[model samples]
Target: MSEPVKKKAVQHLLVWMPNWLGDVVFALPTLQALRKQYPEARLTVVARPPVSEILPCHPDIDCVIPIPTEIGKRALAQMRFAFSLRKYHFDLAVILPNSLRSAWLTLLSGAPRRIGYETDGRNFLLTDPLPVVKESRSIHGSDYFAGIVKPLGIETVDKTYPQLLTPDAIGKQRELLKRMGADPSRNLVIAVAPGASKPEKRWQTERFGILCQKLVKDKDAKILLFGSGGERELLDEVRRFCPGKSAFLLAGLNLQVVAGLLGNCRLLVANDSGLMNFAAMIDTPVVGIFGPGHPKTTDPPIAPERKELVTLNFECSPCRHRFFKECEPSPNKKPFCLEDITVTQVARAVDALLDRLA
Candidate 1:
């Protein structure tokens, strides 16, 4: 035998997933890689309530701890919640977010080896601070996440995309689709999500409706619509613009259930939202619409043959890291960034996807 193998010190790992649903979904590959590297470590994920639902069912995660409050708000609730993490006695903390609050929580959790990117003044909080490389159009999210562990002798990082599949959720998704008049026999299922984290990121709802209608009419594809409770208005706009029996709306379902449903689709056209990441995770082809965000950093890391996605081309693309609460639109003006994107452009993208699928 060569030399005696040194035993790893850590037994419990706490992964601080991103607070936003989309970002949280994007972080799954990192979680999976950690699980593979530390097979015996009790891997726990700490996330907000909505995002928490997706982690529990992941095969890599041993447990999920819901962050008690909106970590986005730097309030007393967040402080108390940070203290609550101390009970887990996490040996390793993986901070995925670039937020100072996330760093503070990792510090308060008392985890000796805190791993994260060196940014947002959070570098001091981390024991293993990886350099945050500045690049445009090449820094994929999965690769960016894996860079942190490069110094720790963990190589051969898995390049697989986000993974999630619960049998019950999958079964329920099938039943729900059937009830919505989607035929399982025909695999020509197409879905569109007319909502994003913000109005700025969202492609025009009318544009989405027109695309759905065209897909139903020309390709006879069964179109389905998805979103959260907040997307009801956009969904209504999709329905109104369609003006016929072309698509079905399935919003506000449990997040995993929605993911499972999206998994069954042949194609998914969505904004740069959590659903886009979820669709990528389930290996569904996607036509992701990007605006007010960096597609280079956040686009689904699937093969080009899977789907042909569309994003707007404006000089003022990617307005903010996170969305603003209520940015007022100008009088006699729509969100021109997304409005500039035409339904014809989206339809062409979808057509290219269909050709690839065929």
Candidate 2:
């Protein structure tokens, strides 16, 4: 009788990364775990354009395939991406994001072993489908992603926060600061990210302006306001309230540059957004303002002592609803859950962080 042939080990692994910036940060631990399990394998990451930009410098990833951002052409984009991925001949495809679209792409890639959570009705597509537990949804985002890899013999240990930076990026940060009239040598630099993807997740910009003024006056800190170009108008509104040389708007900068700038800061005060997670990843002290989102599910995996989460515990506070249309409007037309959190409360939290560092 002829001897049976042995199965070959996984040599090329393809990872379908999460879509949102914060979600992408949360998946870093899983990416690290995958790298540990298959150290010899060529790891490729498939991500959206914004998420792809932040991941190209990641140590574990060999390459990043960025999908086009145009919503109207995403179907064609995915087809093109799948065709490109087929050339790599991936042995295993890990779908980190629980979406039907992700599963379809994995299926289309013709990977031999497809592993992912059995949510979104895509279980039939996966060779190894891990059952989704309702309780798991409430866990921290980093932990949530890490759990998906446990069935593949990769142990999920304490969350690993990935650091992304280069010497060139750091140098650019210093130049950017100087151009913005910020003297890092003269004063402590504090970064403030007042924008959140969701309007309800954002604390009132007026409150942020007040907090900036207070930080400038009391903490003797230079405010480095960070946000996307889309948020330039919102940052301008905050600038209107905070009129001084102390606050410098650093909008529209490269994401890596932003990460490097945040790394240089003494502290980062941000709404529950991607920048907040980025600060934590870079080991910068963070003061996160929470409102509609619960810190339990999305909190950065930083030491509690180093991070201060300021939030109100309203019954409907952590609705986790993505849009205003999904929620019932408050009487004042503003999210009361966020409106209830006072500037004094957030300032006090900021003071606590500063005092701890001091």
Candidate 3:
């Protein structure tokens, strides 16, 4: 009789999560699968600062270690973080982000098995480099992450929407809404996220303001402006265009608080941003405005009946370029792909979604 094959023991696992909020939301399915695969193993997540804010307290993850966003400026901190990880002696490492830095960190921690996609020229650093499929290149973000982890003996079926807030979090958010003068009982609450990490991805603030005004006038919807501290000016611009009683600006709030507040919203209107994905995760209906970002690859993974994407399909619609310098500007010096998406189009989409809800 042939000898029984020995299963390798894996006691500790480390996952280097994606830096962006949307990407992290997309990767939650894989994280959950990893937990189910190794229920007894200690799983640790190394992530960027914003990740801590978005991820709910879950038993799947044993602990979370946060790192600075600017890795280039914090070489000492990176080294210290890597050294600290070495103490855990993780048996396996999963690199979710395609950046070379993420792969380097996994190598630094000395994990025996490093699994990741063979992208960003970091194949040499990965022990099990998965090939990028053409089909996955244009699919939802959650599907892309699921494909990478399929080789780990985990079934990738059932790509359900990820949840970010617990019951307590929802209650806290209701209290926050009361404090902010938003009466969910009286009017339908609509959350608006006007800022994105890249300028190319953001729709005009003026258009957002116009949309809010129309919603307030026609639908009697209460607008909640959500963004970071840096986006305060953009939020202010929208506020300037809106009636004071119709809109409330909630900038610079922590991620958990924002998620809680978003949970109470009936709808979310946002650019192709992290908060856009957050809304989808929490089961809120979303109307996403796409510019340079490709909807196929990054659209919120929500049910079709509950979400809508507004975009102008020009030849150069999804340039995918990070900066304006790399893009070919229109006569008005703005990317027509987004600039051409008129206020009327967005308002119509929002109206359609609200109609469905009603």
Candidate 4:
């Protein structure tokens, strides 16, 4: 029997998702809503290039348009990108990222109904310019992105970020685990992400090393360090301090393979990096060590029992959005924000997770 055709209320819908992994994760709820509303209509996502790789198998989106680099100047890039968007004849465009660039894209897409925050300079381009509530800034990024879609008649539902693990990735992860002598049956497998986008967001390396040692000694867990190319040096520093049969350093793996490996791990202990949010999207329990970034904005939003399992903190945390720029630590060369977070405290959080699992 043939499946009945979905009567299209609107044919095309476009969403401009953020470039960073964590930001993209927050945009998932909006994509899920679009899927529910459109059902069969083509949904295109205008995502930054690095993020484009994940959208091919994304269950929600039909196409991924890479955000082209402006290359020359701001005006030239905007005009070029705007002209480039003329290709997609969209009926309605939902701009998820609140950047003027994103709003401009939606406008240039010439979608009859473009909806986004009114703050960006491209407000004139949007047909439905929704005001960003001052209070909404404090809300979780997941909730913040969800706000833009409400005007599109998109219903709210819990949308954990989506990660597709391929067969090759699974095979590679299994091989790596086996070579590292990771007992597939008994010992707990934990992935530690020791780096963040900005230096301030990073958990103390010594503290992370201590936490790994404690987990291995106490729970007989196997620790694996995961990070991107940029984080290789920091990961190496972590490896130097954490020594024994139970720990392995696995950095610079392809993102998909890392996701696959994380899928099999018992839990992930990470700083406020994209890796932490990636783990949450894959439904892996994550103990996120948040410092310079707001936990409410960056931490996982799945149920407390399952995702965002643990978060380490200090009194004067979240000093800056970027390194020491927006928010800074104290003067006189004394950094108290992440300094107050001790190794013992993180170990306690890990112990609690072990207790819950047992």
lDDT of each: 0.74, 0.81, 0.81, 0.72
lDDT-wise, the better of 3 and 4 is 3
- Model 2 / residue 315 / CA error / Å: 4.7
Q: Report the lDDT of model 3 for residue 115.
A: 89
Determine which window of 10 residues in candidate 2 has minimal summed lDDT: 1-10
Question: Model 4: what TM-score?
Answer: 0.84
The TM-scores of all predictions, comma-separated, are 0.85, 0.91, 0.91, 0.84
Per-model C-alpha RMSD: 4.4, 3.5, 3.2, 5.1
TM-score, predicted candidate 2 vs. hidden true structure: 0.91
Clashing pairs in 4: 319-327, 320-327
- How many Å off is the CA of 333 in candidate 4? 6.3
- The regions of model 4 sitting more than 4 angstroms off are 1-9, 68-82, 160-172, 217-220, 244-247, 307-335
User: By TM-score, how accurate is candidate 3?
Assistant: 0.91
Evaluation by lDDT, superior candidate among 1 and 2: 2
- Model 4 residue 296 lDDT? 65
**Per-model tally of clashing residue pairs:** 1, 0, 0, 2
Residues 206-301 of candidate 4: C-alpha lDDT, one tens digit per residue: 778878877777777788888777778888887776656777777777566677798768888887777788778877787877655568667685
Model 1 lDDT per residue over 148-185, tens place: 65554556577675445666766778887777778655
